[model samples]
Target: MSTTALSKPWTITRLGWLFQPISDRGHEEAMVLSVYRDHGVIPKDSRTDNFNRTPENLSNYQLVQPGDLVVNRMKAWQGSLGISEHQGIVSPDYEVLRPTAPEYDRRFLHSLLRSRALIDQYALRSTGIRPSQWRLYWDEMKTIEISLPAAKQQRAIADYLDRETARIDTLIEEQQRLIEMLRERRQAVIDESFSTLGDPSVQLRRYIKFLTSGSRGWGDYYADQGERFLRIGNLPRANLEIRGDIQFVDLPADVTEGSRTMLQEGDLLFSITAYLGSVAVIKGDWVGAYVSQHVALCRLERDRVDPRFIGWFMLTTTGQDQLNEGAAGGTKMQLALDDIRGLRVPTASIEQQRRIAAHLDRQTAKIDALVAETERFIEYARERRVALITAAVTGQIDLREMA
Candidate 1:
């Protein structure tokens, strides 16, 4: 990290990428020239809209030069700003700004565009408009003031940030790959357990006790209301992860009337409808509201079944087959209360079950640890990339001097 100050009185302006006049093309024919999301441009091929233009339309549409500061006027608040280095055409909705002054570093302009001040301006200006469609009018956006850094200093900071952020990105990618591998190994563990059990003498229903779904007249609540809510959307696919589909809700008094519905350690949560059969286990002390209508809370009778074993089984082929078969409904399949009650499972003695679960847990934990370390490295790389850019632009580190 470098402690460098930028030159004073930095000027700011909106770079309208859509400088060229619209061609003789219909809105539908106007191929999506460019798409920006999360501080990066969406690849031309991955574009879901028809805003990006091919070379055919490039001549008629406005152009974006390399290193120009461009922003998706509509989504600037969501960080849809980037340095346009690719030879690509963007939607007419975008405003591209090329630095008018030689003293202004293009890289410095880009960083400043993404700074807190600019983003806040976009947010405040967005008042009452649909957040997704709020556009930054260049006339209004260009007047936004900024503290300027010396041209040389600006270049240095930009260079520093680029190098450091690249390192962080590499680390994150490695961690993601390792996490995938760990999950695969964990899946194998589950598969092996089922295969090794051979023929079970005990009947599935006799040894296992599956909780039936209760009444389904629960009302809804907002996530921002300060309640910890779990929905079926939170459950990950077998051998996958839980990432942000589910929302939190404030706990309502009526839902927690009895202790039976309260979520606890070792309980398996299953989706009943919508995204049918996705599952996750409550591993530790989790304080949250009761399940939504789309989910079923399963509690295993300890005397008959091991909670960990049941969770593992659900991850295997056998469990999935049962889940699919038991699922009802056409478009959105659902597993009925009776179907879950009737599903078969392999049960073992408490000692055997404990041994198997512990073994798998240790192996998975080791893999998770490796992934976490790689992720930390990725964070360091990201910070370094930003710092490098900042250093180059601020003149704390001179790239020209090194050359």
Candidate 2:
């Protein structure tokens, strides 16, 4: 965790790992081998599908030995560091490093390379010729410097982190499992509400006094003026794509004239278009936008159904089925407003809607907490590994005399 500006002569250039031995033309046809960041146990691949190689588009190079720290030179900043415990052919973009001495643990080295500190430094050094084509060169990668403790201290640190992080990872996995269970429970709740055996509920159509059809097509609003014009693709699959990142088009002056379709808190935005059942609840008091041709601005009768509950249901299996079953297009499929308005919905009393929403809110909050913690552990486990490598190479953690 310390840095110094001193120069050292003990540094040796890395002869990146070799990989030609793992490739072969077998079974029926020639197959290309490749390695991905998900290859090892950190993400836990329980597949027998040869984590080594597959038919990939990229050329393969560099045989990575077990325990060799492999990094994608270009995407090193994006946490693409992994410890290769099995030999595999991967994209030539990978730069595999094996420490010259045992002072550094390979896992530690891999983690350090992926640490925020190293990643930020890598980002700072990178140059992007285009918006997407950014490159981080390997030659410059070697010069990254770090201060480290002695060899004994290095091993002690790695061992300490390995034990602590494993426990954290286990907890994270359990929390993640709990989140999935909550999701399943939420789906069950939806299924029960719609079933005839459940408490009395209202038919979906009764709530709407005026269910008008949506504005024509994308062509009708091309001339619209200064307001957020939302399209089907613009709507996110899960959470609202925090607005700053969402692309918006200006509404023509004529369309913005007193549109009741403006988004509001508790308003349920439904896509009755191609992605027929996708739904999202307005998170806060967002009031500027009007729906695109493909989206429906549902003014839900809040007395019968909670918009939040509807949003959740649409994302669940039952709601998806209800949507898919009502779908009515040939090639580029879509569900018209009439098709959706006539669709049956399971409803409950106001008190019940609030209760279901509150229960789901609590469960989702717990799931979010677990996801955040797991992410943090992933970062730490990754960083600790890299610190071990930085320490060993700089002569700060010396293992030259130990075998």
Candidate 3:
């Protein structure tokens, strides 16, 4: 048979028709299900098992049956649509669909709709000012065109994807475990090096010229391109490097007070709230960046203390223990400026500190390289998985030939 024999263009509505919107008006005693963005439908009870509080009235909920297609309308553009495997009632905000013809493979359609290409189609059809608020209504979703294959071909493709993706997922999991081990090893090295210093301890206040947080009300100065604005979210958990999701703001002449929070190369930063004790060092790239109020800037006495060594010390168990003991507040832990000032830090001679920092910098670079390579491999594996699913469901690749 020709490779393209099974390919046929079909609109989404033609493949599986929408289920008549049914409400539990008369049936108030139904199980409530919630549709997760990427994950499939899950009963609300399961999510709130600890609270054990079911809604007093589920009469407004919509009923869903096995094999029905469920889409969280608000998040449909994010690949939130999936075939329901459970018989329950979902929120009225969700859309439900059922296959119109017996020949349609539900699993194949699920894979097709969740593919990256189709998800982008969903984004195109969605309407909203921002991505977070985008909504894919039924009118747009119904008109989406998809390539269909014969029922047997569809089933075969789904089965092939299921088997292949499982193997890829296993490998990804193994790589994730290896990355975790590498992190632990890096941490152990940092802890050992710091513990063996056998040097005098000094209050952090003595070594630092200034310890202060950023001023508020700078939101008005936020700009797409300007000086980088660092926040608690930008701080890495273990590494001394600052990275990811950095925002920027124009350095307006009137906002001169922000200069105090502006970072210098080799300066140390500590997260004061939420993820307390998370530390990072200001690199050359972030030299002029300003930090948020949630972050504490420590301008070190470079002549006496090495910033890198201080940053690494915070990641060690001893340093964390001291920070943890002084940490205040429940649920949302915070480190007060005074508490941070009082915390004792180990101090070796400047030369020894520089040597230790240099050694760690080299060791961590090696570990970071390995972790980055494994992360790239995982990304490729995920991309391959998505491509395989898209090709199979769209009949871009013939399963019979692969078989």
Candidate 4:
């Protein structure tokens, strides 16, 4: 197959001739199915990460038979459609299409419709105010033009992709497992080091110059472009520094000084609600970020104790237990300002603390670099898999040569 051109004569036809929209009801007793961008169509119960839960009332769900095409119109542009292998029911919001022509292979339809080329088409034809809101209904999808080979060639192409993609997927899974192992090792190193790193310890209150909790009802100050607004999600889970997407807020100058939530360098931030035990040490770029009420801003006596050391200590098994000891208020996990002030931390000599932190810095960096490189490899492997599928289904590859 040539990357730039097809190998054989292909019929360019509208998808309207290939599929007919179907919405058979009264299959509420059947298994529930969902479409995922990466995994395609599978039983909803099989995935633990699905955000949409099954509603108690299944009377409105649409029936899906084997070989039926299911498309999540909201995410069609992201390739969230697949040919179902099970007789199940899906959300009424989803579109189910049954093949009307015998010339097309079921597996080919699954691969072709989910290809990167077709995803771009879905995105182009969708209607919405913004990209996030774009929706591609069947009315628009049916009108899209597609190229297909004869039924025999379609089956051959599908067979080739099935084998190739499986190999690539297996390799990616191996790398993913390795990344998980490295993370476990990283945590182990931190815990073991903290054990003998310090002998003399003191209450965290002793080193605290000032402690304050973030304010509530600052939603009005949120903006697309302004100073960073730190939320609980931004607090690092295993590491000492803040990470992930940052939210910006245009704070009013009049109330900035009184808020006391504007963080400074060397400040320690703790997640006081929801996901407790998460902590972060503020650095240069995060200096002016305003913390949300869900997080507590602890302006410690930085000169007395290294904020990074304290931050790293909080992530250890011993530190996590202490942090969660006072996580109480209601059904939801929570922590009050008092809970943080009275907490105990491993306070070693400044030189000893820096040594421990430096040792961890070197160890974790090596592991982190390997993880990042492996992750990039998997990403590129996925892109190649998609390109192969796109090539096969679009008749760019000579099926006879593959055989």
Candidate 5:
């Protein structure tokens, strides 16, 4: 085992002094950089080229250069600070700092400040009840203290973190790709199962007892606690699973207009707008839940069609293709209630439908288990990455000997 080096507490001002504010009063044409959390400075134009509507005046923006540290004061607590590698102009609200002493490594400072401990320190220094309103001013920021390692160790630590984090990130990317492939395989399975639909075709309305969308004006009934209010976000794309980002709304006596849209067990919910093909079968837990106007409720006749079978079929590519064909509007896609009612569905005997649904349910459960495992592994990798950076930059682990 190697012994760790001694560390000393250094004030922010001692490490690197704040930059002298330089306004773009000359109106020089320069790229605009947006400082983002986790991600460093990025050109605003690269994200969106439509800056034609931007204000013609650029005199209030601050000029930044390579190796300069930039911080979004309002979001500093959220780790929106980075060392810029571009010569550009940032919003006037951002603070720019330059290293006055050569002894301090900018990369080391960047890593250390972004660590969880320093982020917590920033939160403490910030003055606001809400995170969105929190701001870290220059006066308090300059006086903040951070542990400093030897100059040589600073570079070694930063280098070690840069290399290690990249390796972990690559692992995460591979895992994400595996998940995508698994999802594609799941889709393939559903498609194969539906390919043999040789039964008689009938319009969806012939089998569905009810087909209608929820009424509008439910936004005024939003509450912190009540019946679950399902929205487009709660419905996963091309799947029968419901997401956990559920909202609650109080169904007041006066708001009886949307009562018809209240979900029942085994009810099929379909997104009518934006995300057109998202479908989910409402379970017992969501029995009282009501969907937004953007979603449509389809109550199938139990004697004619199995809800799970229909749900599985809708998740297939063929089903999504039919939905796309029926979808209307250009930018904001939507499916009319009449179009949904007119959709052609291949019908089979109830017994065969049950068997198909059972097989698909088993297969999807296995795939979902694998996906959950991969996601958990990715989470662990991310946690390890953060821990490694924290340990290296804070001198908890000595990288000088390793280097």
Candidate 6:
């Protein structure tokens, strides 16, 4: 709570005094609603990304009406509660609350209750031995005291936030669209770079020297200061670069796979497991590193076919299509060493291959930089939105006109 009083008068009261919990259950016929930390409450069927499967029987679901506060007990501290605008049914584990008096504005409560400060309060009040088990049930939630201005001033604050956030959201949407466009353009650049060379009929097996997938027994060679151990995550999806966090493992002299899978400079790496076709070329300091079983080590005939040129081609659409078609599939899809060897590539001079690789390297670097920058901008916009809401709800801003 702020020590300084605002220009408008405010009243401090417990949440229980303002809102009452209603336990009306078994609304299986109603539409399902879900509470998201970022999106608040929305129809469950509207999003495809949520991994949690809804139960076939909705017998225990609770009925919810418009303007009622729906709290996902397990995630309330994470700002996953919201004043619902749709009539639906939420899980019985959630708390359904409605204003006891008309003095409260749903819009005002939406912003205030979900603000960072209030979420911190919710976290402090939540009970659990583990974070995953943390829950904010109604008994503890009702005791939290908050200061509220008159209903009119509350409306003014809510209106201000709604207007400001919409503008920020617009900019964020534009930035996201730009990022998608840039990615498509990046892929097009790769496809176009390889398009000039005639049909890829040359069997990749003709130029390859030795091929083997990494062996298991990963935990046996665990160490902090030793050779780099590259996992499936190290393979980049966009280009032929080995990226992401590195894990170093000390290799035992007796370990047979360590010598067998030791990566060499100019060596081409392919994802032989579930990831399928992501490829990277080892360079400089990464030469002595070993790979996990999921990655395939392909020591190419560098004289006949440039390693980087082949690596870049593996990222192109045509390359990805061949790998997907040839990979063995059932529950899990994966590529065999022979499948990689069987891949076809455009037969070209080593000089032309180097030129193609160079062109893609430059083009992709520019696109990746732009995508990173745009993502940062979106992040900043989200931070600003949260800050604005917190300021409004905490009475840090004066809304004397609405008083």
Provide the overall lDDT of each model, using Cα atoms, as 2-decimal numbers: 0.61, 0.55, 0.79, 0.85, 0.80, 0.87
What lDDT would candidate 4 get against the real structure? 0.85
lDDT of 3 by residue, 1-403 (tens): 3445343443434332533333433456666777765457777666643353556777777778777778888888878878777888876678877655646677787788788888898899899999999998877777777776666777887788889888989998999999999989988988888877764378889998888988887788789999999988999887788878878899767658888888998888988886776899998779999889999898889999898988888888888777787775566578888887887888788999999989998988899899999999989988888887776777776567543
Taking the tens digit of each residue's C-alpha lDDT, what string does model 5 give over 1-403?
A: 3436434442434322534333443444888787877577777676554353445787787788877778888998988988887888888788877655546677787788788888888889898889899998777777677667667767777787889899999999999999999999988888888788864278788888998898888889899999899998888875687886778998877777768998988888888887778889998678888889999899999888998898888778767877888885566678988888887777788999999999998998899899999999999998898887787777677454555
Question: Pick by lDDT: which candidate is best?
Answer: 6
Ranking by TM-score: 6, 4, 5, 3, 1, 2
- Superposed model 5: Cα runs more than 4 Å off: 1-3, 7-22, 25-28, 44-60, 198-201, 219-228, 245-258
State the lDDT of candidate 1 residue by residue for 201-307, as single tens digits: 44345544556443454345555655445666677775333435445556467755434566766766777886655777775424444566677777777765777
Poorly placed runs, candidate 6 (over 4 Å) = 1-5
Better candidate by lDDT, 5 or 6: 6
Global Cα RMSD, each model: 6.0, 6.7, 3.7, 2.5, 3.4, 2.5
Question: Per-residue CA lDDT of candidate 6, range 185-293, in tens?
Answer: 9989998998989779988899889898888889777787888989999998877878899889986676676888889999899887767778999997788888889
Residue 311 shift from truth in candidate 3, angstroms:
0.8
TM-scores for the candidates: 0.68, 0.63, 0.85, 0.91, 0.86, 0.93
* Residue-level lDDT tens digits of model 2 in 1-403: 3343223333333322211123221222222233344443122134566455434443344455566666665666665566665655444566656655545655555555555566677777666875256666656665666444444544554565566657666765675676577556655655554454353244446665434324655444444345565567656554323233343455555754426656666666667666666776665435666666667777677766777766665655666776787774456577766765665656666777677666666665565566567567656755554554454434444343331
Candidate 5's displacement at residue 344, Å, is 2.9
Which residue pairs show backbone clashes in model 4?
A: none
lDDT score for candidate 6 against the true structure? 0.87
Higher-scoring candidate on lDDT, 3 or 5: 5
> What is the lDDT for 295 in model 5?
93
Q: Which candidate number maximizes TM-score?
A: 6
Cα lDDT of model 4 by residue, 190-300, tens digit: 899898855426788998888888888778888999989888889877787688897888877777542588888888889998688999888889887788889988888
Q: Roughly what TM-score does model 3 have, to 2 decimal places?
A: 0.85
Greater-TM-score candidate between 2 and 6 = 6
